[model samples]
Target: MEVLRTPDQRFAGLADFPFAPHYLEIANAGGPPLRIHYLDEGDKDSAPVLLLHGEPSWSYLYRHMVPPLAAYGHRVLAPDLIGFGRSDKPAARADYTFERHVDWMSAWLTALDLKDITLFCQDWGGLIGLRLVARFPERFARVVAANTGLPIGGGKAPLPFKLWVAFSQLVPRFPVGWLISKGTARGLTAAEKAAYDAPFPDERYKAGVRQFPLLVPITDAHASVAECKAAWQVLAQFEKPFVTAFSDGDPITRGGERILTERIPGTKGQPHTTIKNAGHFLQEDQPARLVAVINGDDAA
Candidate 1:
């Protein structure tokens, strides 16, 4: 697979993203080795708090949430999932697949030998991260699911999701920054907007971004339907500390948090919150609340 690495200069001077980049190459991942970029902060030996982002956004999405969590005595590790952010981007959309995404992340997790994880996943982050938890439950200590879900392909896609899928494919230029801004409740500033656009200098670098929405399992014939069903089997038995922190303004994943709260054995009495005045990217709309939830700071 031909991969595109964004020019490091494109990432320079990014507003609010001050953490240095770290790399780990995934060897034998179908084709050439791909370097995954991540933000590793706070105490190295502290219990890991893994932050996973979804489509069109990267570790940069967690810039506001990372420092406080790190300061709260947790090692924060936020990674750019394969094609987004500073990670290597596969040149063609076909090179991106839901299973391959799972495999790549599984490799990255083992490579770091990270354990006793606290997962805060959103968007496609939940799609891939939840699978990791099901496949390797021992690695996780707890889960805080925000604006994400494990969708079984037996049902139809939500109307908003279907429209998003269509828009991603048909749009001439994949506007990364604009898309992120649109998803958040409050709009982004000029500099903040540019940072989201930083990873993809051009259209060729956005293949993964273009393909992520389509990878969501919405039909019985979808590529990931069977495995997603299998993952659900594992999750149904998950009794870890699970909490949901969905926003009030996202129509796309409006009712997704219920899947976890109602099904997962872990969420019996946990505090699940609806982030008011927030949208799909609550990290942008409600960063303090997100950070508070991640750090167990309910007072916020």
Candidate 2:
């Protein structure tokens, strides 16, 4: 598994991103350790808020939310999933698998020995982050799911997602910045778009990005179908404080939050919100609302 690490310089001068980078190397099958990069801020003693981003994006996605959460006396930690952001990128698409993704992050999570976590997961973040919760339910205290789901490969994926899967594979140049901008309601400034593009210098670095959409397990034949099903079993029994903060403008995950609210016992009395006027990347569209939800702010 030949892994490529993005140059630290690419991340320099990113718009609205000021946190210093921290790294941990986790074991990789048939290869040397893989380095995962993350942002650690706020009071170290406080129960941590774990922010997970999804396909084609990185911890940079949480730039607007981190500082406030940290200031509110919460430890905020956002790791770039392997093959995104400052993390080591596996060069081959075959090297990226849904289970391997979960394994990689699970190792990172346990390595930090982090506990009493409040998770804010979006996109593939939810796919992977929720699995972490299922695998180590004791580590989490609550969850905020946004624009994401834990698909068991039992239902037909919406048309928008099917189109996205096709686009992720067929596009000549994977447009990381453009894709992120397109998923947000207010879109991104040129610099912000460039920041999203910072991780991948060229096509070779995008194997994980290109492969993520295809690994959604939308069909029963998908490899991770059984694993997701097993994860769902754990989620169905999850009684922690779980809340949904879905946005109204996302076509791909529209109404997806219902599955969570209905299935998870934790949703019984928690406040679930629809971030109006925001798109898939509500972190960019409504970061404040997300922060408020994470903080349990009544006004949110």
Candidate 3:
């Protein structure tokens, strides 16, 4: 593997993102070194909360909620999935895959020795993180799913997602960062916008971004379909604590929360909420509400 790491200078002076950077090198032979970047906040002894961001976004998405969660006495750890944020970016679109993503994150979690973690997963975060919990249930304590689902590739995907996949491939420019901003409800500020743009110095670093939309298993014949079905089997029996906090305005995945609430045994009694006014990027649009849900403040 030709392990590649993003230059530290790229992330300098990210406003309000004060957490120190950390890294883990996972096995990815015949490809890039697979550098995973993360942030560890609050006391190490406190209960651990793992914040996982989704596609086209990074740990930067959780800047607003980190401090408050830390203040409430939980150790918050947020990681920028490989190819996003300060993590290494592979040069080829084929280099990014569902199994590879799951393996890379699983290695990082193992290397960090994180156990009894409470997970906060959104978008691809939920897709990959939920698989981690299902595959390695012993390491997790609870899960909070927002704007995410576990798709097994046997059902029709929402229309918006299908259109998104088509547009991402057909578009000539593929403005990765700009497209993310537009997906959010209120958009981002100048500084925040700059932060999202910082990771990719050029289009070459966006191979993973461009490939992610295509990698989602949208049909029953997809490669990862069987594995996802197996993961769903594990999740079907999951009897721990699971809660859904989906936003109301996300056209792409508005009803995804129901899958977890209905299928996972863990979600039986937990309060599920539909956050209003937020779009696909709920962490950016409703960070305070997200935090409240995680802290059990909004339970009825």
Candidate 4:
């Protein structure tokens, strides 16, 4: 496992992102050393809110909400998963796997000694982050899931996800940043678009992007199915507080909130919301509404 770390110099002067970078070396030359980058905001002793981002996006996805959450007197920690943002990027598309992603993030959590955490997960963030919660429930305090799910691939995937999988495989250029903006209801500004594009300097840095779509467990027989099934077993028994705040316009994961609401015992009686005027990238389109959900003030 050869580890490749992107230099801090490569990420200098990103717009609206001035948070200092923190890295953890989770895996090493005994194999490939996995480097994970994260942003730590507010006082370290404050109650911790763990924010996780999904495919093609990094911790940068949480830029807008970080300050508000910090202002609310909670510490915020957002990590750039291996292969995204300022973290180490593996060279091959085959290097990324669902289980690997879980392990990468789980290691980061353990390294940071984060516990009793409130989790805000979206997109792949939910998929990977939920697995962390399920496996290590003692570490989590509460959860807010948005536009994400833990799919064990037992049935047909939603059509939009299937189309995305196909498009990711077939597209010649695989516009990493453009796809993110277009997937949202309001779209991104030229500056915001450039922020998303900052991580990948060229095609070489996009192995993670190209690999992420294929990593979704689309069939029941997928490799990570057993682990996800185990996580589901744990989640079924979860009695902690859980909430869902999904965007109304997200065709890709519109139905995922129902899975958490119905399956997780913790979701009972919680104020779940469907944010209007937002799409798959709800955090980008409606960050304030997302903050409202975190604060438990979204029209409960």
Candidate number of the best TM-score? 2
Candidate 1, 1-300: lDDT as tens digits: 888999999989889888999999997456899999999999999999999999889899999989999989999999999999999999988999999999999999999999999999999999999999998999999999999998887888878888998999999999888989999889999899899999988899989999888888878878999999999999999999999999999998898888888899999988889999998999999988888888876665
Candidate topping lDDT: 2
Local distance difference test, each candidate: 0.92, 0.94, 0.85, 0.85
Candidate 2 stretches greater than 4 Å from native: none
Order of the predicted models by lDDT, top scorer first: 2, 1, 4, 3
> How large an RMSD does model 1 have?
0.9
For residues 1-300, could you state the per-residue lDDT of candidate 4 as single tens digits?
544666667677777888988878886323567778899998799879999999989988899999998888889999998889998888777788888888888888988889879999998999899999987999999999999998887788778888888988888777867988997888888877877887887777788888888777768767798889899999998999999988899888878788888899999999888888998888888998888788767483
Residue-pair clashes per prediction, in order, are 0, 0, 1, 3
- In what order do the candidates fall by TM-score, top score first? 2, 1, 4, 3
- Model 3, stretches more than 4 Å misplaced? 1-4
What is the Cα-based lDDT of residue 254 in candidate 1? 90
User: For each candidate, what TM-score against the reference?
Assistant: 0.98, 0.99, 0.95, 0.96
Which ranges in model 4 have alpha carbons more than 4 Å from their true place? 28-30, 298-300
Worst 10-residue lDDT window, candidate 4: 1-10
- Using alpha carbons, what is the TM-score of model 3? 0.95
Per residue, candidate 2 scores C-alpha lDDT tens digits across 1-300 of 788999989988989898899999999888879999999999999999999999989999999999999999999999999999999999999999999999999999999999999999999999999999999999999999999999887678788988998899999999999999999999899999999999999999999999888898888988999999999999999999999999999999998899999999999898889999999999999999999999998579
